[model samples]
Target chain A: MKTVWTQKGFLIPAGALLIAILLPIFASEYALHIAVLVLLYAYLSTAWNVLGGYAGQHSLGHSLFLGIGAYTSTFLFTKIGLTPWVGMWIGALLAGLVGWFVGYLCFRYGLKGPYFALVTIAIAEAMVSLTNNINFIGGAMGLEVKWLGNSPLLMQFESKAGYYYIALVMLVIALWLVYWLSRQRFGYHLIAVRENEDAAEALGVDTLRVKIQASILSAFLTALGGTFFAQYFTYINPRNVFGEGPSIQILLFAIVGGLGTVWGPAVGALVLVPIAELARGWLGGSFAGAHLLLYGTVMVLVMLFMPKGIIGLYESIRQRLKRGSSAPEEERTPA
Target chain B: MSMLTVSNLSRYFGGLAAVVDMSFTVEKGEIVGLIGPNGAGKTTVFNMLSGFIPPTSGEIIYQGRRMNGLKPHQICELGVTRTFQVVQPFPDMTVLENTMIGAYVRHPNTTDAKRKALETLERVDLDAKADKLGRDLTLLELKRLEIGKALASEPDLLLLDEAAAGLKDTEIEDILTLIRQLNREGMTLLIVEHLMKVIMNLSHRIIVLDFGKMIAEGTPQEISQHPAVLEAYLGKDE
Candidate 1:
């Protein structure tokens, strides 16, 4: 009777999944690729939301985990005969370890607010430089996955549908993880720490430990997405994985959709990715940076008008409607 | 036996002495009142005793153990818990969640913590608003929640910092009755209050502070009659 699919929060996700499954049948190859891109961005934003939105620790360097995951998994798969599936877990572990270290250093030293944001940015830049200079895993040129000829063992398939399905599964897992955490005791503790660290500490909640746990959990999930991306594209580059673009993309979707809400990033990705693809298709040749300009304007408007993001706006309207209907019912009842 | 003892406790903020040479002892199952005018270091004493701000010099013995340098949470774990003057409830959490955090000191398991938290909320008459967000609580409810939180820790020595401040007369009376009940239940309490009637009526013995110094210590009737206490209150420039 209490099936996971029948839960209150699963409705939107279930609908999204149904649409994702059905779209490939009617969509063009270009449209399918856009859909894949949307899934990828959605996954990344949802991963970032765990730490940025739920924990109230705004991270601008989430690509650090993505890069680490991509490189670690790809390196293992190429150097050894290991499958990408096994490498995915390894990458997640490494990323989680690194996140733990970073969290410890930042929280221990009381690096917070804009200063913490700067630290993440600096780390992202540093990771990029480090990856660029490292020669073992293809260095600045990047790594390419060997063609496996539709081998399920290697997680490579000839069809784009394979990639789409994989991305969908990942999106589902990420969404589930966020939802589970948002309802747990750990989530409440994370929110308390986010709202006021001193008060949380005084109340016997280990603020530092909670922050570190959130960071590590967030990194682990984001790293899995990274490995999926590497396998899906069969390519990995420092600019693509560790670059500012991926970081900004993750933060943008999370913010534009609704940072702390369950479906904020998914909704953000769904809205933004299609528009971006359409813009690129129409004016990409003549107007080079037009898509970027449009994105910037849209983001600025979203921030100014709907500070809580689109989902927040939707919720407010829903609440008002419920109140309106309930008021009339109460009036008629004459309590 | 003394539940809490502070000797030669001093705290310096930059060049000024906020609390100096403060020494006191609270017996088990006694209600002791610390009364002072604004900025007389009443809160500083609470802060030092509860390990919020470490004393610049001296020792605090709680249950015959030195507690001067321990962290606030550690001190809380040692059966000493304090409520803030400004009431620092976790604003994003529900009242139950906030209280559960306090209960976590004694009961680490979620079920046990919830059970304890509920019992403590009932003790403070806050069980009705258990599901309400901390931010949505009224001033009276907030104060009750503050006390409820300290109670959740199962403290042997409970410190109250202006728990009755900014309440209606009836609300204050309600809180006073609760405090009396808690005291009657064999809980040791140290209360800081500006209201003379509440302090005089509630405290068996009162300690008065003026200019960060212990100006007087006596029964409530003696403190009211002390010439120096009256001068300290009246001599201040209005």
Candidate 2:
């Protein structure tokens, strides 16, 4: 608990945010677009980290909520002319309920580790199939938001800066939420459950309730990203929104950045997305999927060399540097 | 009339009975020792009392409330907490953070729980290593942390499973002193230990189990000479 004003650590984020706000003035539209994509992934991945990283419940099917958010808001906007700003909240609520139901079914029966991951993937796939057969919400073809040039009220923007700012604001809020939780009892309990469920239970932590709450929160926030995705792209098919690709992309950023840390996912997105986008831009004509190959290779290298992710690596390096500055405590021999 | 009362408790794994028709009552503020050889179901009984598993047929009444069917956390919330025979530390967390998890049961606020955990860590003589990660601790420190974690919850009754299982004689003596100090401070303890030195030195009353059945129950002195207890340990001469 040091207040934000007192802590020197707050400068990193503050500085980063300041840089992000001013970047639009000098940066090209392409860079801004990549920045928006980075922010969106960072937001979604941070939401994923609440359950996957902090609670040690790796969910690979978060696209279920993503699809829910995209479809809900899109359907409302397309069919009934409801504004997406209001519709996004409804999508978030629906995603939260589904999150609760999914969490209840999996955690109530003690499904954990790989089994829980499989169940989530299964559920998301089932949603994909269900959405495909349904006609009311455009089925497999998907819904498209009606184009309205420079319409702020409808969340459609003429320039990339509007979406960039929205994405930036969303990411900041999500990061702040995670930072706040990290200092709270819920965050501690989630880590406790992650470390050892039986030990946590013995310590009087309600593991099930903590985990379920994490699921609901993670799903709700991820659905918000889904709505943002729909608004930004103006088109979201079930395959793109609720498919395995989006789900994998979300968790990858969390994993690569740092599983449990507040800024890890954002850092992960910050580093990886630009590289992917740039590689595709530079090498697309010669090798269509070469950038993906590079991305996958980089991911493999990170997992092999930095399994705890970039944050863990940074922490260990800092610890070593600190130790180097002072005489370290003598290691006690085992009794 | 008792702090904890168990009646006709039994747990059968498939056709094999781990513990059967066992009953005991622990008075408040008393240090009770449960002793048995390996697979004698000492740990099984501890597991039942702490709500790690349910008994097949029986009742566990603690302070006038039935404990069966309740989750382990609920059991801990009701002023009962247990430590494992194998130490469990959150490896990624600092020692202070690990202890804080238990303090959080009573102190919901982070600052308040941290203060409480620090005090508990001091009580366990682990204050110096508060900043160390749980994974870096020595075995003796891990054991102390296990007890410190349970103590942080401020339990009315603490269940310690083999708290001194893998300690040197001097280390055992050190832990015995800690246990003695805890009892003197009016904390009730139910200990399951294979080491006679620990059980005899600490328990106010000792219960001996053989084949999951209570073979002897008495003060340490009386239980030492009890024939069934001797038979359970040394096996009938000739």
For TM-score, the strongest prediction is: 2
Return the clash pairs for model 1, or none. none
Candidate 2 is scored at a TM of 0.98
DockQ scores of the candidates: 0.48, 0.92
| Candidate with maximal DockQ | 2
Local accuracy of candidate 2 as per-residue lDDT tens digits, B122-236: 9889999999999999999999999999999999999999999999998898889989988889899999998998899899999888898888899999999999988888889
Q: TM-scores of the first chain across all predictions? A: 0.94, 0.96
- For model 2, report DockQ: 0.92
Residue ranges of candidate 1 with Cα displaced over 4 Å: A1-9, A21-26, A328-335, B104-132, B236-238
Docking quality of model 2: it rates as high
Tens-digit lDDT track for model 1 on A30-49? 88889899999999899899
Q: A1-335 in candidate 2: lDDT tens per residue?
A: 87785687788889899999998999899989999999999999999999999999999999999999999999999999999999999999999999999999999999999999999999999988998989998889999989978988999999999999999999999999999999999999999999999999999999999999999999999999999999999998879998999999999999999999999999999988898888889888799899889888999999999998998898899889888765444444333
